[model samples]
Target: MKVLGSGQYRFERVESWPNVPKYFEMGQPSDVAINSSGEIFVLSRGKHPVTIWTPEGDFIGSWGDGMFSATPHGIFIGKNDNVWIVDCGAHVAMEFAPHGELLRTLGNKNSASPTCEGRLVHAQPFNLPTNLAIAPNGDIFVADGYGGHKVHRFNSKGELLLSWGRQGREPGQFELVHNVWIDSRNRVLVCDDENDRVQLFDTEGKYLEEWTLGNPSGICIRDDIVYFAQLQPFEDKSNGRGSGSISLYNLDGVLLSSWDNTAGGNKDTLIGPHDLCVAENGDIYVCEVYGWRVSKFRKIQ
Candidate 1:
């Protein structure tokens, strides 16, 4: 069996996992999420925008054929198994029922907030939003990415509550806020991707601290552990293969293990890792945008 990582974090790769249908072409799996029933939901820019599968890699079905824009960026499953997807190209975020019924939509379709004029701009709703997270209190936090540098929080009713962050290297400012996640403690974690760090904030958008992860693009929190799927390191871009990796950290911001292989020989190696999710039983699924693949790593230790 092909293995990666070490210590309590070791994982064995599952070869050719999630048997993709021969009739379907899975363009680039932008993000992945697991529902309460242990079903895997992959959001891609493929023919079928959303594909569902069992944990055992059996294909179940698909959804959202013509409902989404050409670029679907992220997927997050809530406690009720409802799926939230962010469309960067359309500049909107949407919520859907497990069966593909559109529940709600946020932001104007194809309308981006004013951000291209300058780096330091605080915009409204979304400007190419990338990902979202729902707090236990029912507040929705969105990472307005690509064209903006802010995080917008909305109520459960889809009403805008507040927005924060600017474009800078400062503590509260963000460069590319790619993803957002709310831990069990209600701490708001935003992936400051371009700044190569994850910024922690209070529910009211107060700056707490930050952790330096390499171009952290994706974030997932299960129990007390935080998982990050990072993009290629800035220093190793000349490697040709592209060096991307996943990092695990404790709730208190302590690094546990980071696994990667720039040489690209190992099956567990990640390239252009844009997003990740942990299964109910601790299995890991990582999506690589540039590599055009999603790798499943079964927990070994």
Candidate 2:
């Protein structure tokens, strides 16, 4: 891991984690989440299973060796401290204990086949089910990103409640609904990555409002601030592997600040920043796909 930028935004390679195996190499780590104990769990696209590590970057353990079909994209640490892994290749969401015990799995292995249940259409032909967001009451929202271009909502027990949207560039439509997050007010925010915007909807899937972002990918909410991993399109012609940037917005959708690898003097930079998580102490952990690493930043007042 290379440190980039200056001031309070400098990136430092964590050189001393306790349990990391010296021989394990990871693929593009697309997303990341930290547990209450400060352990870091990374979801990668390289292999079938994901990797776990300490906040200090020590590899702890891994699970789900051969279960993923394509690649695992989005992941979240629930309020209950359970780990939810979204395997896009298999089009399903698997839940596990914080201790890596497999608890329950959702969705069909063959998602290409479509099935209907009453008024709810359960379509497995959905391409990539990327990221997920859990409500305060335990309702789960899955972004059917790559293939189907829809959002699937499920109850706490894995029962499908409803699904919405289709592939399109128009409002109320998503070309690639890559990620989802439930705000403090319970509003569902969907990162329409390909469409270059964020769409907000009610809990029942009704469109409320939308805002523009520069090729936004992973999204997370900490208190009143919403954090977005902005992956600028190729046309930007930025320097470094990726100009991996972070955009901060208020609850009412006000742009507050933009932080990047350029913040510090170092230029190792952030490339393909796919996901992000904020620690309780205001530290930001960004996972980059092409960079094959995770960068951490502390928020300074």
Candidate 3:
């Protein structure tokens, strides 16, 4: 799966977890989250279950076998150590205990309509939820991506507070609201991915401002820095050998350092890097779609 690009970036491939089930081998790795214990959780597309691995690349465990029908999009590890898995296939969000226990699942498991008050009624009828963010008050925010293009907020008990956003390319409008994260100020940052930018808003969905990132997919905010996994342009006919790059930006959307994927060569160069997570120790874990592997990068300086 090595791919070479005209740019200075090269992609390399890395073997993952030795041998796992055949079903886990392929699909796009959509979102990644690292827990307080340094465990990496990846929401992959090929299989309905989410895979968990140690920071050292050891297979820790896996769960959510048949819970999703389409694709598991976004994932996050809360401050309380609970794992939140967002299933775009099921059009719902689920919470699991640290040890893989099912704490609570949100959304109607068997609804067929797209307009449910508190949760998703029909799986494909509603907006596809991409990623999730937890507020300081324990409120959960789900970025409804493909279907309806809205951000749904819920209380700890799964009660709907409010939902906003519609389909458009304008500043307040969201063409593809891919991911969301809460900063230290409790402001919500939505990765308006398709718009080629990241838009900042308050918890109430008020439009603040946005900054470009070429083709951004996933984002994580740590301290005063925000890390973005920017995918290659889709229109390029390079036989999927496009080189993805990671960009570091500040809270005000100022560009810092940019890392070309050449660290792994062509195959290891990130292809369709959808999600990323930063460990407490400043290590970064990136999940890729075409490569089907998670790579870790550490800060040298």
CA displacement after TM-score superposition, residue 100 of candidate 2 (Å): 2.5
Listed in order, each prediction's TM-score against the native is 0.94, 0.85, 0.84
**Which run of 10 residues does model 3 get worst, by summed lDDT?**
3-12
Q: Candidate 1 — which pairs collide?
A: none
State which candidate has the highest lDDT. 1
RMSD of every candidate to native, in Å, equals 2.2, 4.2, 5.0
Candidate that would win on TM-score? 1
The CA lDDT of each predicted structure is 0.86, 0.75, 0.72
Deviation of model 3 at 279, angstroms: 0.6
Model 2 residue 133 lDDT score: 87
Q: Model 2 misses residue 18 by how many Å?
A: 10
Higher-lDDT candidate among 2 and 3?
A: 2
Off by over 4 Å in 3: 1-27, 110-126, 235-238, 262-268
Q: Judged by lDDT against the true structure, how good is candidate 2?
A: 0.75
Model 3, span 1-301: residue lDDT tens? 4432223222233445324555545356778888878888877776445777876677777776666766788888899999888877677778998777888877754342363332342223345677888988999988877765778788888888887777677877777878888888777888888788888889987888888777788889877678889876543456755567788777777777666556434344566677898877666778876566677665543
User: Residue-wise lDDT of candidate 1 within 131-248, one digit each (tens)?
Assistant: 9999998899999887778888999999998888888889998889899999998899999998989999998999999988779999999878999998875334465355688889
Residue 45's lDDT in candidate 2 = 66
